[model samples]
Target: MNKVLFFAHLRDAVGEESLEVEAGGKTVAELKAELAGKYDLPRLETVMTAINEEFAANDEVIQDGDVIAFIPPVSGG
Candidate 1:
């Protein structure tokens, strides 16, 4: 299973901070697409994704057992 993390508004939107699923080693875009479909998160387009703490492109493939984090832009004091 692949481990995925979430932060800020993204977590609140989904009402779940994290999730794990058995998926293939597809690109980040593929993963995002699947998740978006499942969660119905229309704002996913505005969110940023990372793998192993490194900002990554949508086409970046996610390896098995990877730690992928979803972080939305945050504005605060």
Candidate 2:
């Protein structure tokens, strides 16, 4: 299983800070697709992604037990 972490509005939208997903062998894009489908989050693709605390590309492959974080762009005045 892969741990998916949510930040900022992404967490509020999903109603959780983190979730476990079956992502072994799946690419980051695939994981995002699954999450968007499950959570009905249309903007999920716009968030920045990180795997195991390092920035990841959409095509990055996911491994079991990897920690993936989805951080939405933040802006404040």
Candidate 3:
């Protein structure tokens, strides 16, 4: 299982800060799509993704025990 974390609006969308998923072998894009559909999340195209605390591209493959975080853009004045 992989640990998936949500931040900002994404956390609210998921109704939790984090959850475990069977994401090993799936690309970041795939995982995002799956979660978005499952949770009825907002469009994730602009969200930043990280794997194990390091920024990752959509094509990056997830591995077991990896931690994935989705950080939405922040706006403030």
Candidate 4:
């Protein structure tokens, strides 16, 4: 299972700070689509994903046991 981390508003929306998923062999975007269906995340388009510490495109393939993070841009610096 691959591990996923959610930060800020994403964590609240997903109802967890982190979770595990069988996301290997899938593009980040595909995985997001799956999760959107599973979690009923209708606003998923507003979120950003990261592989390791770098921003990742939806088409970017995720590695087995990769560190994936879901972060939503928060206003107010």
> In terms of TM-score, which candidate is strongest?
3
Candidate 4 lDDT over 1-77, as tens digits, reads: 88999877667778998889988899999999988888776577888899887899989999898989887876766
Looking at model 3, residue 40 earns an lDDT score of 92
Residue 56's C-alpha lDDT in candidate 1? 88
lDDT per residue (tens digit) for residues 15-69 in model 3: 9999989999999999999998999999798898999999999999999899999
Off by over 4 Å in 4: none
Top-scoring candidate (lDDT): 3
lDDT of 1 by residue, 17-70 (tens): 789976558988888988888887768888889888889899888888888898
The positional error of residue 58 in candidate 1, measured at the CA in angstroms, is 0.4
* RMSD, candidate 2, Å: 1.6
Q: Rank the candidates by TM-score, best first.
A: 3, 2, 4, 1
lDDT of 2 by residue, 1-77 (tens): 88899988888889998998889899999988888988987587678899999899999999889999987775768
TM-scores for all candidates: the values are 0.87, 0.90, 0.92, 0.87
Lowest summed-lDDT stretch of 10 residues in model 3?
68-77
Model 3 / residue 70 / CA error / Å = 0.5
lDDT at position 41, candidate 3: 91
